[model samples]
Target: MSFIKKRTSHNYDIYESRGHIIGRITLLTGLIFTFLPPLFLWLVYGIMPPSKELINGIISISSVMLPVSIVEILAFSPMLGTNAMYMSYLTGNIANIKLPSAAIALEVAEVKPSTEEGDIIATIAIGGSVIASEIVILIGMLLIVPLSTKLNNPVIQPVFQQILPALFGSIGAYYILKEWKLAIAPLSVAILLNLVGDLPTAVTIPLCILSSILTARLLYKKKLIKVTD
Candidate 1:
């Protein structure tokens, strides 16, 4: 859908932002990085040949990325106007602040309030999707392992593990433009996390959370930041 919003002030707040242009640029770049994950699997495995699967599948998948990149470039793009409208309809009232489509879609579609009938159905649906996805991936592994199993093939794996630096540079460039300090904290924690993943998430989550909070507390205690004081 065209993202050209109407000219009303209310609509402007719904659809416009100061960094709309830059947001589109970085998001498109981010989306390109996001596309690399699945696209790598498709190319490495030759998952779908055009002759059998037809062109529609290509179009369908591309739409998801288009929205990720250009926000409202696709029908389900995270347009604030659309978000406001959906929120107004779904929750029975328009909110003062705009929410992204991702949040509203989750609210309206996935997260149902618990009722007397049961809360188990939602959990079952999530588990069911997980199982179904695993089955599909297992089938792909079976088909592709034999077809493209050359151990020493040139394209088998990247010679230099370049994706890491490239991703970090791209994301770092974007964040450094705005919030370099906020960016550093996550990068610091992620580096620390790489060595600690052997721990269960149940353990790791609390550890990381507690560590970050304690670190923040210590920083605040030194009178470095006034909010905590």
Candidate 2:
């Protein structure tokens, strides 16, 4: 029975194998969509942006964006797990929409992320969110002209401009309220550094992540915050 069981193996491994295959297929499809459009434009027009200008643009964009993207992958993957990552990257908006939606779903389900159950919950949440986002985008596309006019109208511009800040502020306030002790040190440092007015944007982000992590560690060691199992 033992030998047969060993040979038979666990079903979870099979699921993981199939998941990897699906993820790779999705990644390939995403890459095709990404490159095919630009290639088509270049082929049809027989025109491309100036090589030097494109190179400079790439460099300027990559220098700042690449590091953040790498950091985000490292920082977020554990919370998102593999299935969620596939869905998130494919659909876009990992930070603003997918990640938050996954986090909230996991919290509601009372499951720690990266676990099997968490992966299932995250995948479901992200899938639903992707559908909902697409529907909203379709509606927006249909109303683009009117929406753009209203948004750009002088009376409404301030409100539109403030929407992002207000949204993040409310979300941040919710988490901070839940665990204010863990948030204080990082929030304080961010506020102080921002007041300096000359610090590089790239430097500020990693500094904030590090400071918050270290602060949390110190608090945990001091038992100011109870460590969960």
Candidate 3:
């Protein structure tokens, strides 16, 4: 028996497939993680107005850019879940405005296989679509420039280096340290990362996670520690 699959069309139906609770969890976690840092920073700034750092207006706009993009994204997501070509053939059929936008986005993101692999094509397509959506938003912002706020004043950059990491570390230490064993791995890895002059979280977090999991497993296996699910 062959373990090969056939070429499937990358249409709206791809997203149409239901029941991805893991994806939902990821999204919810995003909603939590992305906001909390900036919020705490804003609060701290408000409280003791940093001497060197001025919170510019653009930063404020950039801060809420997520919720705004989310609102726009939700407002225009397609409902029909049909092929883009078919949708283009009959764009008027869709009763909703958001459907057309989402359809357009799906069309933008669909991969056509070349000499390269399918995954590469899909990655390019999806990345292109995200860039396109951001471009559209930027265009909209330009149209209403007076209404738009400033983001990332130069003054805040240096301050961010100190405040952002401290905020995350403090919070993680507070909540995740309840389990002392789980706590040690992060502490160790954090120190390691700092000593190594800082790799990205992409490298740092996975290392810590794998180390913690293995440490926990080993300790339990040797009867040095107990695990509770």
Candidate 4:
């Protein structure tokens, strides 16, 4: 009845346990720091926020974000591996930076995600990515005024604007093609949802993930997609 899987490779289990223990500690530390500013204000300055307002704000934000956060944790952890999860979450910006970096590293290493080798690669990738991103941010901040001015130029604006879409599209396209059958249901449903109107992204994301999982299951059952033992 252990949450961590019992692996034949004791080293793997040990590594996973260590990672989870550290990750949880880091997560808790982060949560405490996140509320530190408000707590400091209340204690030191007596600038206490209204409890009713705080409750309402928490409810409003959590209603949209909490479920998405849960889904993200479940969906990304296996693919990212435990150490990578700790690194990526600690640094923030997973989808836009850490995920793509880890994916590329795994692809380059020819390692399957969720495997021991993948865990190492993911940890390295995320760690390296976090370092590189921080360096880039530091450099960008130093030249912020000049960089912002240049980036805002009409000629340069479109490139900056499309960067996220382009990056995700290129990386995502490869996986989508690799598992086209699995992609079809989710893609179609997502498109339909978009056409219906502006659905909250939190709702859209989990729905798409659920649809993709269901489609994959059905396809496997129908023998359209193979499930290897």
Number of the top lDDT candidate: 4
Best by TM-score: 2
Can you give the lDDT of residue 199 in candidate 4?
89
Where does candidate 3 have its weakest 10-residue lDDT segment? 85-94
| Cα lDDT of model 2 by residue, 195-218, tens digit | 988776667777777888898889
Put down candidate 1 lDDT per residue, 48-132, tens digits, no spaces: 5565466777776675544443322222222223223332223221211122222333344544323211122323333344455
Better of 3 and 4 by TM-score: 4
Candidate 3 residue 28 Cα shift, in angstroms, is 16
In candidate 2, which residue ranges exceed 4 Å CA deviation? 1-9, 198-200
**TM-score, prediction 1:** 0.27
Native-to-model Cα distance after best TM-score fit, residue 92 in candidate 4, in Å: 1.6
Q: What ordering of candidates by TM-score runs from best to worst?
A: 2, 4, 3, 1
Clashing pairs in 3: 57-150, 58-150, 58-151, 59-150, 59-151, 76-98
- The estimated TM-scores of all candidates read 0.27, 0.88, 0.31, 0.83
Candidate ranking (lDDT, best to worst): 4, 2, 3, 1
Candidate 1 deviant stretches above 4 angstroms: 1-125, 150-152, 159-186, 191-206, 212-229
Mark the regions of model 4 whose C-alpha exceeds 4 Å error after superposition.
1-8, 41-53, 152-160, 227-229
The lDDT, on a scale of 0 to 1, for candidate 3 is: 0.49
lDDT of 2: 0.83
Q: Over 4 Å off in model 3, which ranges?
A: 1-18, 21-162, 198-200
